[model samples]
Every structure is written in C-alpha cells, then in structure tokens.
Target: MMQRLRILTSHAAVNLMAAACFSALAALAVWGPGWVWAFVPLGVGAQMLNEYNLHRFVFHLLPPRAQWAFDLLYRAHYGHHDFPTNEKLFFVPVWVAVPMLLFNFGALWAILAALGVADAVWIAVAIVPVGGVLAFLGYEWFHMTSHLPVRKTRVERYVTTLHNQHHFRDFTKWFHVSPGGAVIDRAMGTAIDRETLKTRQRSEFIRTLGLRPDDPRLVSARRRFATRYGLTEGEIARAAAH
Candidate 1:
C-alpha cells in the first residue's frame, strides 16, 4: 500500500538523520578525545535505560490523561502485538519518532542544565536521541523484515524466526531488540527458550480449538498438522490460529 510505503520511507529517513546527528556528535567529541569515550557509554546506557522504561511503563501502562498519546502508542505498539506479521504497521511513524526525539532531548538538556552540566549537556542530549533513534530504527527494520514473505539471510532468518516464535508462541518473552536477542530478556525472565516456546505454542493451539490436551480429536488433529508442518500438532494448530 502507498500509505505503508510512505510510513516505511519516513521511518528510514528519520533513522538516517538520527544516525547522522549521532555520528556528528561523536566526531565532535573526538576532538576532545579523553572525554569522548567516557561520554559515549554513558549516553548509550542512558538511552538503553530509557528504552526499558518506555517499553515497560509508557507503552504498556497507557495512563488515562494521555488518551490521545496512548491511542497512538497502542497503535504503534499493541497494534503490533495484535497483528505481528503486518509489515505495513510495523515501523514507528515520524509522528511518533519526531515528538519522542525532541521531547527526550529537551528534557535531558533541561535536566543536565539544572545539574550544572550545561556546557557539555548538549553533547549528551544530542547523543541520547540519536542513540534512541538508532535503536528504534534497528528494532523497526528487523521486526518488519522478519515478517516479510521471503526467506531471509542466515542471521535475518534466525532472528526473524525467533521473533515470529515470540509473537505466535510466547508474547511475554523475547522483548529485546531483534537479531541479537539480548540478555535483557533473560535477565527479566522474559526470554522464551525455543523448546519452551514450542510447548507454549502447542498449548495455546489446543486451547484455541476448544479442545483439551487429552481430547482424542485434538490429539488427532495435532498429529496431522505436526506431520505436515514438521512441528507438533499443537504448534501447527497454534500457528494456524495465530
């Protein structure tokens, strides 16, 4: 769809601009080399912390006063949960990205200025949004491409498959940025190991078909579906239902 293509294009453009800004800041800092390394990790870590907070709190909580904002967030996030393979809706639109980037940078700058880091705060604030955008871009791309119809490259195939499993089998786990499947999910006890996900998928499938695990018809269907898909009957059923 043209609308979907426009969204993707906008996302890609924002990502490029964010990357350029981040690189420029890094390059600027390099002139004062000693402090550059120190700042880089601090900025990146801060951004990661922000990512976790936004994902766990803002996106999931959906506080009442910000109904309009929540509606947009839900569309960008929960909507993805509702239709994981819908590539058109996968990326964060510029409407979301632009506001978030400006707000974060502005807020961080204000905080740093208040804390007496005004001179160097620009560098830090600049890096924060850039880092955030880069992370978001990577997340969007990997997630959208993962659901593409064609088979992917080796690494893409692995990550895409893993993420697909997370969506269809275990939505609670594997909440990290795509491709790497970061330890954050494991640390949070949200990482669904492959086998565990397979089991969950099967269980969900059985539940969806209005069949119990011990039902003969359910068992028969599971077996048939499993044989055809090279998965357990439960997995096949779950995949189909999803």
Candidate 2:
C-alpha cells in the first residue's frame, strides 16, 4: 500500500489535489460549521458519478478521425488502454485533472451561490476539495493498483477483477474504478453480467479500443509519444504486431 501510494502521489495532479484537500480540511477546522461536514458524503457521491460519466462518455468517446483530435483522446485515455501497464499512463494527465477540479468546484459554487445558500463557499469546499478530491484520490489508488502486478487485499482484488474485465474483456463495460463504485456502473447499465462474461470472448483489439493494433492513428500516436513516454522501439513494434 505504501508503495502504491508513493507511485500515486508521484504525479503532479495527485499532489495538487492532496494539497488542496489538506488546505480545505485545515480551513474547515477553523471556521466551517458542523453542518457543513454533513455534505462530505454528497461530494464523494458526486465524484463517483463524475468518475463513471467521464470514463464512459468522455474517455471512451468514438476515436476521432483527425490525428490531432485523436491524440488528445489518446493522451487522455486511449494510451492507457493501449499500454495498460505503463506507470506514466496510470493517472489522469494534469491538464485534464486540474481543469476538472476547477470546473466541478466552480460549478458547485455557482449553483449554491445562485441558490442563495448562505455558506456557498464553505459548502462547496466541504463537498468538492474535501470530499470529491478524496474520492478522486481513491479512484487513482485503486486504478493504479488494479493495473499493477501486486498482491492485493480482498477489496483490491475485487476491484482488479472488475477493472480487468473493462480492459481485457470489454472496454464498454465496468467503467467504475473506485471501490464500491460498481453500484454506479450497474445502475448505468455498463456493468457486465456473469452470463455475458461466460458467453463472450475477449474483445478484439482489447488493447487498442477496437482499433487494429497497427491502425495508422495508433502507430502514429506511438511514434509521437515514444520519446515522451520512453516507449522503446521494441515496445512500439510489439504493440503494432498484434
């Protein structure tokens, strides 16, 4: 667990969110009302919902035909699928994660302020920087662990099973990576049933999101990011050859 956390906190986005969470907690300790803490679970629930929606809708969107557009999605998610074990691909990129944090917190604050909630800033703080960011951290922890070769607790093992199904079995299903967030997947109709698992074969192009291994876009993406991500020539060739 310590090792996984070290890997997790190594990312800029995680560190930023951790700092924000700690600052929010410290500020809350000084001036936040007791009732504000009650909304922490709501923030957590919001993030869980955000986790599912973003994975299913944004990250898993149809691969754009334009190379530049495809590259954005590739960095945002497809590269992770293409090289599931790459530690650098395990966390959300800082660009995506930081903007998302701003948007979620800002949107919640705007809504609360518009609604005339007297404690809009503090309430938004309670829910977002405190609760939502914590859940996002949990999502990152489980996600990174799921992709690594490590002995896991019962819960981590369970999460890995579901996440592996999404990666190795079917990209369209089991979108939730955080523990206990399977409820969202099931509710959203993205969770796979045992019967389907029994009947279906492993997905074609599982690593490439239904794109052929040598699809020009993927080939170009690999080359484009080879130096950036330290993908070896051998790894690039291997990825292209089925």
Clashes of each: 1, 0
Local accuracy of candidate 2 as per-residue lDDT tens digits, 143-214: 999998989999999999999899888899999999889999888888989988775455573899999899
Alpha-carbon shift of residue 186 in model 2 (angstroms): 1.1
> How far is each candidate from the true structure, as Cα RMSD in Å?
10.2, 1.1
Per-model CA lDDT versus the true structure: 0.55, 0.91
Q: Which stretches of candidate 1 lie over 4 Å from their true place?
A: 1-7, 10-34, 61-74, 179-181, 202-242
Candidate 1, residues 19-127, lDDT tens digits: the string is 6566656655665335444454455555555555566555555323444543455455644553355454466555666677767777777877788873555455445
TM-score, per-candidate, Cα-based = 0.63, 0.97
lDDT of 1 at 42: 58
Q: With candidate 1 superimposed using the best TM-score fit, by how many Å does residue 169's alpha carbon deviate from the native?
A: 0.7
Error of 2 at 225 (Å): 0.8
Q: What is the lDDT of residue 175 in candidate 1?
A: 62
Q: Which stretches of candidate 2 lie over 4 Å from their true place?
A: 203-205
TM-score of candidate 2 relative to the true fold: 0.97
